[model samples]
Target: MPKSPRKRALSSPHDALFQWTFSQREHAVGLLKAALPSSLAAAVRWSTLRVEKGSFVDRALRSRHSDLVLSARIGEGRVYFYVIVEQQRDVEALMVFRMGLYMMRLWEQIVRDQPGLKKLPPIMPVLIHHSDTGWTAARAFQDVVAVDGPERAALLPHVPCFELRLIDVSGGRAGDLVEQALTALGKVVLWCLSVSGDDARLEREIARTAAALDEVLQAPNGLAALEALLRYLVATHARFSVRKIGRLLEKAAGPRAQEAIVTTLDEIERRGERRGRAQGERRGRAQGRAQTLLELLTARFGAVPAEVSARILAANEAALVAWTTRVLTAPTPEDVLVEDGKRPAPARRPAARKRARRS
Candidate 1:
């Protein structure tokens, strides 16, 4: 059969972009500083910041979004501070509830990972929202709960309540972000992601961001970061065409920027080709397996029924393996197909009444 047209990539480009950009220690620290309160931010030992592995939020909720968890020493090395980066494209009304759940999960993980820990780390949840519409939902978990007047006061002590630090990037003001972000790379990334929806603003700010990144680009990891950013822009924004971006790069940082852009685009194309090849190989293997099972069934039990044949062909790799294994010892085709240790129940018909004899 002719292969169906390749579907668009299953993964969200925004998720990939967010993870790649903020995974760096400097960028993560910059984001934390910008989002956290001045007093709280000052207490964090920025140099001791480290990204934690695994996610606390449910996998279903994180399907097309990205989050970061980091731990840093605070209180002059006496305590640990936890920061959760909840990056979302839209405002969520149940964000506080989700954050609360994530916090509990994080604490559980901490206890599991550190057997002798004396205390749980203090957690600070930050919501990084970037949507066309500004965030208008309640920022606190208490606000989400149903309580009125005196009842609310009564329930306050019993309820788990906390607020998330909010960073709204909906305005798409590159200058303000640049001033707010701590590092040069952070500024550029924040500007790019913030202005992704606005072509005019992105074009206006690209030159300034490029100039700022020039010094950083000279560093060892600068070129890599630049490539990542360019790839992110191309992947996340529909307005960012290669030609347009290439021209912008050339204008901003001249030949070096152009070279970086070409390199990044080439790498992206290579990855896509590799993924396509791998997918084709898997499909070919699956088809071969299906065909082998059908041949076995036909040889062992004579002509396979259309329904059975269809089921065998539709079966995934695991099911095919199970059927293939059963074909050798099963007494009949139905026995081979039906699940192990279970038989299909016999059909029953309704009985006719004999009331006419009485009449």
Candidate 2:
């Protein structure tokens, strides 16, 4: 089944973006480092060993894991790395809360899992936002701090954050990178991925963009990434979000890029169509079942009101599903009510009886 949207809040845009861009856990790590500064990138070893935990809020507690993790040996001390990629086009203030929770959990896990280790390394939370919201200045936990007194203020140091703004690097810069990557038709690919709707106009823009990319970067991978991007757009049926665009870029890069994008896009579309059909069928069946029950109620209760029928139809799915299931075993409308776990109060029976007697 195509996965339903994730209900729990995500840690950061970094984590979300990582999953979208690179399907594989390890690839996300490599790609992340590539985007970071050279000094930090060189010291780190991207580890594929990921830890999974149950859903923080649910009963089944399904596992949610990190996007990429690594350990860096810096000045005789080993620092642990945890990165979450996000590609949201809008601000999500709630992410701070989610990240705070994840950070606490990670700290607990580190202590429990590695008892021999003396100390934990400074953990850096990185956010790579690709939104038209345009990049806001990078912020860290330290930035929000307030020292009420002079003594308290003296002890605190600014906690630097690892945040990168890719939006600052625009179309012209992107084309230059494509040229260096030696990809054929690089800019064309980028424009196609970025352009919204209007296929004919987009095609013209793509051709022009491709020519620009050719002017800058003459690399093969650039071309590959571009091609893969086009195929992905043609394949997947999603609105163009920054995260989706990043995913398309990742899907487009490499030797098998074109083929992979085609396959994945086709699969996503097929699964989406199937899911829609299944949901429709479920809804139709539920409606059918409810209609049958309404007819029975009208027959047994002597003309059930239209308002009551609408209420039943508009009821929640969980309630509707249960009610529909009960209808199969219920003998009458009264039986359906009890089967649905609704029972009349004994206190009301005398009044109902008096009213019926009077009528």
Computed on alpha carbons, the lDDT of every model, listed in order, comes to: 0.69, 0.44
Predicted structure 1, TM vs. truth: 0.78
Off by over 4 Å in 1: 1-10, 76-90, 115-119, 173-181, 195-208, 212-216, 238-253, 316-322, 334-359
After superposition, candidate 2 runs with Cα above 4 Å error: 1-17, 20-26, 47-79, 86-102, 109-118, 146-276, 305-308, 315-321, 324-359
The lowest-lDDT stretch of 10 consecutive residues in candidate 1 is 1-10
136-229 per-residue lDDT for model 1 (tens digits): 7888899999899878898889999788777666665322232564677766666666776577876786777666667557756766666666
Q: Judge candidate 2 at residue 252 and give its lDDT.
A: 32
Encode model 2's per-residue lDDT on 92-178: one tens digit a residue: 444444555555666677778879877765655544333334445434444444455775556565432333213222222331121
Error of 2 at 196 (Å): 8.4
lDDT of 1 at 170: 68
Which 10-residue span in candidate 2 carries the lowest summed lDDT? 1-10
